[model samples]
Target: MNEQLTPRQLMILVAYFIIGTTILVVPSALAAEAKQSAWILQLAGTGSGLMLIALYVQVFKRNANSNLFQINERLFGRWIGKGISLTIALLVFVFCAQVLYYIGRFVTTQIMPDTPSEAIHVLFIITVVVGMRMGIPSIARTAEIYFPWVLLLFIFFILFIMPDIRVNQLLPAGEFESMSLVRGALQVMSYSFLPMFVTFASLNAAYDWRSSMAKAFVYGTLLSGVMLTVLVMVSTMVLGPDNTTTQLYPTYVVARKINVGNFLQRVEVIVAFLWFILIFIKLILYFDVVIMGIAETFRITKHAKTLTVPVGLLIAIFSAVVYPDYVYQQEWDNTTWVAVALLIGLAYPIALLFLSLFRKRKAAAK
Candidate 1:
């Protein structure tokens, strides 16, 4: 908890942040819009991500000595900064709850159909709450340790599923409405790229002097983008865009297809577990960010852990009631979540960067 994140840790954190729930849900999300062109449209998201990485890295480099709290206060003044911080915290809290919902919904529907969603939700939230209460370094370290296993499993999954990809499935990229393609790209960016922007407020993962956070973030985004592109391609090829779109968890469905001479069958559960691990990492990171934000807003300098249990309790109950089912979740993800993510992730950072630059020039002119 007391340790600072290294370059490697920062890169891993960003990768996991982007990968979070994006991998689990992206196939269906993209298929709904772009269909067979889901692969190409996802690559478009990398462009959006590169643009965001540049803006956020500038923020990170300029405010190396300050956390997001101090940077916001310095840039926007106290009242506005507090308001901004509260918004960021709320987003983080909601995101945490969403991630938990993903775990519960996945487990209940796929693995443990008879198990109560509330039971799964409580068990999962407890893990994240404990890890988060430890501190930023703890969260970063957890990412560092598990990232390799995730990378290996993901790559192996892609390889094992390679023989299943059909070239014809990804064809007909030109037929879709360009607006639909554009919308698909936006959804990809919202899921993959914008997370990079939101996490700037979680700069509690605060980089050490030896590492360049901007460079680490660029590397991480590129790697995660590549992974996402491959996943989209694979999903479209193996499952066909139609199947991918219809299945609620297409990636998990795709994973169920792994079989090499029947020796490596039923390994889809491994992929499912990996997704759960990724969700845990995601939820914990957001949980820590919200707690830190609240403490900063109220000037709770010490013993912030006191707030953890109650907040965790709130998150648990909230997750249970957020959406009655996955349909409502899908609706929110498609509509309201976009505006929320863009406001906090895109608009806020860009505005802050402009203000910081303007203020610097004003000071210089003075």
Candidate 2:
């Protein structure tokens, strides 16, 4: 693995990873709680996300050249750190399965209703496994390649849907309950930001974590945050809060409204394509970090690729039962996921940083 990712590539990966499943699910999720003020929740979430990225940058600064697994070992000693690393790896593995389930479900319900979700899971997992086998350089490069197309499609989606936006849809904005806004913001952070803990593992692939790289990280978050905010806001204004809340993928539905002269109609596939790019990048990155974390935890550097197929198979199996039903999924996303994301993405890093400072002080005294 003599691979290195440029800052530009890192930026693209971060942006795509943040935008991944968020583009589809967020509008409805936010609308459910915040209603017309859903976009405000997104703004707050994104702001907090930038703050988290700053914290991550500090963590990376303290533990330069080491991935999250190695950082755990360095901060907590060998066995305990390995235990922690393995746990995090397993959590990410579960996330991979969840993402796989998301894509499979999306396709079955939205695109190909006749196709079995299991088939979609298997097919998508194969691509992820293949991408992982190619290593991070390839994955980063692929993201860079797809970045422009994603940006263009998103811009076009916003532009074409402008005509359908109803200002009155957002007329009663800022009228939500305080708890509802808090919950909505937390949900947005849980889905769009907190899972970025995986990026700590990816930092090892970067050429350098210099200031430029740090800026790239923030830039990625900002770009994705703006895109998500706009998407959420537009969904509410165009589809109304009621429609956005009721639909599973309000953004996808919004795409159906892109009718420029009727000739440019029925381009909902563009939304799907954009999501596939973002989701695939995110899925592969998750899979990559899972493999890396496990290998580093066990010192299996030479044969990490060997674990790919077995891992892929397990993810596929897990996808089959990740959710008992969509109702359960919604419950899990709103409630369970926030706690889980906070644990892994927020609390875990803070713990490591505190330990790092404690060790530094002890060493200084010695």
Query: Per-residue lDDT tens digits of candidate 1, residues 116-223?
Result: 988999998888778877777777777888988998999999999988989999887756788887788788778877765656555633676555766888888888
Looking at model 1, residue 193 earns an lDDT score of 70
TM-score between model 1 and native = 0.95
Q: Against the hidden reference, what TM-scores do the models get?
A: 0.95, 0.97
Residue 144 miss distance in model 2 (angstroms): 0.6
Worst 10 residues of 2 by lDDT: 198-207
Q: Score candidate 1 by lDDT.
A: 0.81
Top-TM-score structure, candidate number: 2
lDDT tens string, model 2, 1-366?
426678888888889988898887888988988889999999888888888888877777777777788888889999998998888889888899999999999999999999999999999999999988988789888898888898899899999998998888887879889898778778777887789876545455454865488888899999998999899889999999998999988999999888999789999998899999899999988887788778988899779888899999999999988886899988898788889999988998798889988988999999
Which residue runs of candidate 2 sit more than 4 Å off their true CA positions?
205-207
In model 1, pairs of residues that clash are: none
Clashes of each: 0, 0
lDDT of 2 at 216: 83
